[model samples]
Target: MVSCKNVFLTLTLVVIASNQCECGVYSLIRDLLQWNVAGIPIIHKTVKWDFDPEVSQKRREQFFELHGYRAGKYLERIGLGIDGKQRERAYQHAIRDQGKLQGLSILQP
Candidate 1:
């Protein structure tokens, strides 16, 4: 009793719906890893930084603030995301370690 055209339309709709569902799941997983594990958002565009330390530092902080750290405490407050302060401490520690390895005196903040 079903017409061929009706069957084809149903099949097309089902395929599209399934594809959208799959895409949503993939996006959720990707966001979890990016923001929660890496403490960084998805950078959609090319970002440039200045060679000057002060300018670079300001730019970096602004970037973090604008994109936000750990999805702005949504995941972080729930303890599911990486803590921004902890990430900063790790960064500072790495800088110190690098300075020691290179035998250079790195200025600390």
Candidate 2:
């Protein structure tokens, strides 16, 4: 029988991996693209522009610790600015990068 510790470790890894993204980055990209195509406002003043660097750094570290280098680069590439519409490209890149790091073969519909 497998040891409890081994099972716990496996479960922990699975949980950590699942925290990377929701519905995959490709899907997010597609959504953003569609939103743009539809002439919907992509950027707004309501969006938080000044997320603390310390918090972002902590989150980035957590992402790296959980997903490793490739994933970390994905987030780094996206950046944390409050430029709403202007930041789409970076956000998309980060999402794509994160997807790659997580071993997710998801495609945008």
Candidate 3:
């Protein structure tokens, strides 16, 4: 027989632990943006923008479509997320790569 209180505690702990991963989506984005603003060069330490560069071209195309859609729809207020080339480059090391693949199949053709 499980107590309701215990169940609630377990669920709460699970959610907390899940969010405490080494690097979460929120914190990762924040750090990436910070690095972009600071002009620091990325060395693939924590954030990884492109998980797999070997994916099919069709999948690569989806990234392009979603990139545009998401920028206009969600990131319009965030200033189009982390700019690869820096929106202004106010710092010397601004516009870090942040583990993004230099090129993808979609860009080839």
Candidate 4:
């Protein structure tokens, strides 16, 4: 005995709630990026260099020599070594801790 109007209202509320959740996630990512940028030391600051085709080609070749297929396999192995649940828990804890540090009550359902 459910009416179409009631179903529409329910769906609208669910969409709104999901949007709010997405906003929270985006906000958290923004905050994390800000934290990472702030933590970088001035000693390791990046320099802007003029584009030189010769230099670019040399660096590209150097990168491929140092970090080619073996590097990709090494990274994949390291990624696979991490447990999904453990990584999720660590991620959740980081969000909660960051929220607490910023005096924001971020509730994850």
Lowest lDDT block of 10, candidate 4 = 29-38
Q: What is the TM-score of each candidate against the true structure?
A: 0.19, 0.21, 0.19, 0.22
Q: Give the TM-score of candidate 2.
A: 0.21
Q: Find the 10 residues in a row with the least total lDDT in model 2.
A: 30-39
Error of 2 at 40 (Å): 12
Candidate 2 regions off by >4 Å?
A: 1-50, 72-109
Better candidate by lDDT, 2 or 4: 2
Instruction: Compare the candidates by TM-score and give the number of the best one.
Output: 4
Better model by TM-score: candidate 1 vs candidate 2: 2
Two-way lDDT contest, 1 vs 2, winner: 2
TM-score of candidate 3 against the unseen true structure: 0.19
Evaluated against the true structure, the overall lDDT of model 1 is 0.60
lDDT of 2: 0.61
lDDT tens per residue, model 2, 1-109: 9998897566555545555556565455545544654356655436667656689888877978876776865565455454666477667766777856445555753
lDDT of 4 at 30: 46
Candidate 1 TM-score, C-alpha based: 0.19
Off by over 4 Å in 1: 21-109
